[model samples]
Target: MSEFRKCARTAEAAMRSVFPATPLQLNAHLSARFDADIWLKREDLTPVRSYKLRGAFNAMRKLRVSAPDQTIFVCASAGNHAQGVAYMCKHFDVQGVIFMPVTTPQQKIFKTQVFGGDNVEIRLVGDYFDDTLAAAQTYCSEAGAAFLSPFDDEDVIEGQASVAVEISNQLGSAPDHIILPVGGGGLSAGVRSFFGHSTHYTLVEPEGGMSLAAALETGAPVSLAHVDGFVDGAAVARIGDKTFARLSDMNLSDVLAASEDRICATMLEMLNVEGIVLEPAGALAVDALVDVADQIRGKTVVCVTSGGNFDFERLPEVKERAQRYSGVKKYFILRMPQRPGALRDFLETLGPEDDIARFEYLKKSARNFGSVLIGIETSSPQNFEALFRRIEQAGMTYTDITNDETLGQFVL
Candidate 1:
């Protein structure tokens, strides 16, 4: 066995003292849909509701063992990583200072504090994560504290490799394909290192945050100009330097960029259909299965459900995104005649299945015309086509704003 595999095995054993291995269960629903043997490596079921705890525990344990005098540890994260570090800080009885973006959800901040109890101190630093990370590093240096990188450090990668070890042991052998969600690349790189060529690997990242894909294409890590925060858990601007070193040789074709809207749709499906709650990043692997349906068919495939740290407050946004992606909903602006019974005439243009979700009268653009911002929900995308055609035939004009990002943000 390779050095990484050996160290990963040791980390797996050490993890039992903190938490038992997460489940690797066959997903019948996904299997039937994809015509494959779909197994879910349920990292979401961990104590911190993420695989992040494994890395945090391994890194913190090694630090404490190597430097017994070191009692303070620091890290910066907006979500799962913060909770994991806080949990381990409590376990190691060490003080942990966690810095998170000021815009981080209050639910995540509260959970981190609860997990660490008195051992953790949360500092809401900057609005942006880069600013927050810089502030955390500065504080760690000034305080003579150990700094923990969520994915870049060697120890954290070794710890994350434990997930692969557990999956192989539970499955009785290496799976034909292991699909992993990539953020800074800790979990995917670690897992890949442990298995090597013994198992085929597929890496998934958020469509708006294709850091891993960027690294593979450029032969080195490069910062993306823009990153969509929709898949907050896995949306990283750049892949970690250390993690990318391990992934540098990967096939670029195997790197799948999962759409953020599609991820939200997957999240809803897994929740409603399978009773499995997956965050957007957690759903990446499963969502990528659509792109690999043919290759994975009749093969044993594992999709790592990486995190379940979903905030229920985002449910409305999740539902909206899902609807938009599934084409069951739409938004548009209607030009109504500024005369009585014109509203009734416009109402008649809607199909029987179409329901008005939102309607607001904006300013009158002309003496005879007024702008009406409208949202319509229906049973199918085809319904919108029929509804729009009827409106056109009725001598009225409208603009489809469902895909207009700038306009939707302002009016919807």
Candidate 2:
């Protein structure tokens, strides 16, 4: 075996001491739908419900041997990495301090605590993740603690390569195509390095957090000026410097940027149809398949359903986004007459399946017309065009605010 393969195997062996290998199972629903044999490297089923544990375990194992007296480890993360480090701390009976942004959800904080038990200390600081990361690094330097990076370190990348090692062994061959969701590029770098020259690869990144794309364009890692944090798991502002070095030569054509709302549709479809619970980033690879259908058809494809640390509270938001992306829902600013029966006349245009999700009169804009914010959802996307057509014929002026960012942010 190559040096990297040996390193990955060693990491895999260490992981077995903590938890069993995650399953590699064929997904018939996806296979039949895409006309491809789809296998999911179900890293979501791991003890930490993410592949992050593999990196954490491997990094700690290597560090423990070299610096046994270094019992304190430190890390910064808003979600999965924090939990992974905390879990590893508890498993190894070591102390760790995890710094997280204040914006991190309570559910994530609770999970990190549960995983760490008494071995980890949670520090809430900073509003943005970058600020928290800086704080953690400073704390590590001052406290003499070994900082455990989530993905940027060489050991962490090598450890994450274990996923590819397992897939190669289980599948008996490199897959035709392996779809990877790019965050800091650690997992993608690990998987690509393991496959060597065998497998065709595609990288999927969230549109708002296309760090990989930015890195590829700039020929080096660059922080994004703006990022949409909707897909919290993989929405990184910058690709890891070390990991991106390995991925810099990859073809730009092989990378895809999935819209946040479109990703939501994939998440809900998998949940309601396949009974699979996937965090937003987890669904990126699967959703990207839609864009690359021609390339993967009739071939054996593996998409890493990377994590499932989805908090249930976000389900409503997910559903709303999915509905809008699928064209079955919309919000509108209707200019209604101030006279009575105007609301009734507008309501008459509704199809049987159309439901008023939001209805509120903002204020009277003029003596003759009042501005009303209306949100309508229907069983089919086609209903909106018909509804709008009727509105036009009836001389009812309206503007669809569904795709209007500034307006939607303020009102919806």
Candidate 3:
């Protein structure tokens, strides 16, 4: 075995002391759909419901071994990494201080507390992640505590390599393809380092936060001016410098970007079809399979479902996005004439399968015509085509705002 793989094996052995290896299960639903051998590295089933705890535990364990007196660790995270660190702190019987954005959901905060128990102190620090990270680093420096980076640290990278180690051992050999979700790129970097060119890799990122693509284009990591935080677990503004070094030579073609709404559709499909709940980031790798279906046909492929920290409260929004992406739901602005029976005429245009989800007048007192906001849910996408044809044939004026981002944000 190569030196990197050897180290990864060591890391995997170390992880057994903390938690058992996450299962690598053959997924019949996905395999049959794509006509390929599909396996899922179920990192979502980890004790903290993510693969992050491996990295945290390894980093802290290494620190303790190298410096027996080092007992304080600090970290900043709003999601999976925070819980991972908290869980490790409790297991190692060390003091850890975790800083999170004040805007973090109460559910996440409570989970972190429950995991850390009395071993870690939770600090609600800043409104944004960057601010929270800065505060954590400053506190760590002042208090002489070690600050554990979520993805930028070498120890953390080595820890994450354990995932690859487990995969290789479980499968008996490397698969034909591996799909990985990229954020700060720690997990991808570690996995790629361990496997090298033994298997094909497809790295996926959220369309709104393509930091890895930006880094490759710039020949270096660069901060994005804006990032859509919808995929909060993987919506990093910039790839870590350490991670970029490992992925610098990766082909840009192998990197895919998944749209937020499309990812939502994938998440909902896993839940409704397979009884699997995945966070947006967790579903990214699976969602990217659509872009490379031809390349993976009849090949053995593995997708790492990174995390399952989905908030059940967001199920409604997830369903809404899935419906919009699937074309079963839409919102439109209609110009309705202020004459008698105008409303009746509009209602008559709807097909039997069409249902009015929302109908409200933007302006009710116009002398000639009133602006109305309407939402429609239909049984089939073809139903919308027929409905639109009827509206056009009747000389009714309407604007489809379902895909109009600015207008949808304001009214829909």
Candidate 4:
């Protein structure tokens, strides 16, 4: 067996002691929708609700075998990686210090603690992941502890490769194509290495944080100047250095950048229609299929649903993005005449399905007119066309600010 395959086997063996293998179930909803055999390698169903635990367990197991005397492990993360390390610390009965950004969700922090139990210590270090990572590394060096990277280590990559191994074995054949979400690139690198030209591959990443694409462009890993952190699970500012080394040869054509709003639509669909709650990163593979329609149709495809550690508190934001992506919701600044009953006249023009989501009057900018911030939602995208036409016919002046990031951030 190749060294990579050997490591994957070890990872698979280690996982069996903790939990049964995550199911590789064929999804009927997506299958019928795409006219292709759609299978989900449900990493979301793993013990930590992500594939992260595989890497954590494999890396820790190898460390214990090689260094026998080392008992301390440290890592930094805001979500899945923290939970993964915490769980592994409990299993291996080793001391672990996990540092996370203070801005991480309480739900994630709580779960990491729960997984580690008495074996792990949680530290709130910084407001950003990069800062948290630096602190953890420093602490590890000072304490002479082994610092575990979330995705940069060879052992971690080998551990992640086990997912593809299971997919291949469970399906009884190689898939025609595999759609994977790339964050730090561990899962994608490991999976791609295992497949090794046997199966075609597509890498999906968030548009606001295109780490894999950036790595491909630079011929090496590079940190993004700015990244949108909405897809928290996959919104990495840079691909891991080790992972990029393996993925450096990938062509730009194979990578797809999914808009944050477009991704939210997939998240909501899986939740409401498929009864699946996927974190934004978990939805990346599925969302990218829309961008590669011709390549995936009529073929057996597996889209790795990477994680399901979605906090319910973000539901409102998810819903808003989904609505905006579908064009059934819009926020606009309306120049309203200050005449009495003018609001009534505008209301009269809305379609039966149209509902007012928000209405706020801004400071008077002109003598006879007021800047009214209005948010309207309807049952379908077509409703917006009719609504906009009605507003124009009524002689109401308005500017659609639905897609305006700067304006929406401040006003909406």
Give each model a TM-score: 0.98, 0.98, 0.98, 0.97
- Each prediction's whole-model lDDT (CA): 0.93, 0.92, 0.93, 0.91
User: Mind giving the per-residue lDDT tens digits that candidate 1 earns over 1-412?
Assistant: 8888999999999989989999999999999999989999999999999999989999988988899899999999989999999999999899999999999888899999999999999999998999999999999889999999999999999999999999989999999999999999999989999999988899999999999898888899999999988899999999999999999999999999898889999999999999999899999999999999889989999999999999898899999989999999999888888888989999999888999999998556558888888999999999988999999998889998887889877876
- Which candidate, 3 or 4, would have the higher lDDT against the true structure? 3
Model 4, runs deviating above 4 Å: 362-366
Name the better of 2 and 4 by TM-score.
2
Residues 1-412, candidate 4, lDDT per residue (tens digit)? 6788777877887789987888888999988888889999899998899999999988999999999999999999989999999999999999999999999888889999999999999999988777998999899889999988889999999999989989988998779999999999999999988888889999999999998898788788888999998888889988998999888888899999999999999999999888988999999999987777788889999999999999998899999999899898999988878888988989998999999999997555457888788999999989988998998888888999999989877987
RMSD of 3: 1.0
lDDT-better candidate, 1 vs 2: 1
Candidate 3 whole-model C-alpha lDDT, 0 to 1: 0.93
Runs in model 3 lying further than 4 Å from the true structure = none
**RMSD, every candidate, angstroms:** 1.1, 1.2, 1.0, 1.4
Candidate that beats the other on lDDT, 2 or 3, i.e. the better one: 3
Clashing pairs in 2: none
- How many pairs in model 2 have backbone atoms within 3 A of each other, for residues 3 or more apart or on separate chains, i.e. clashes? 0
Backbone N/Cα/C clashes per model: 0, 0, 0, 0
The clash tally of candidate 3 reads 0
3 or 4, greater by TM-score: 3
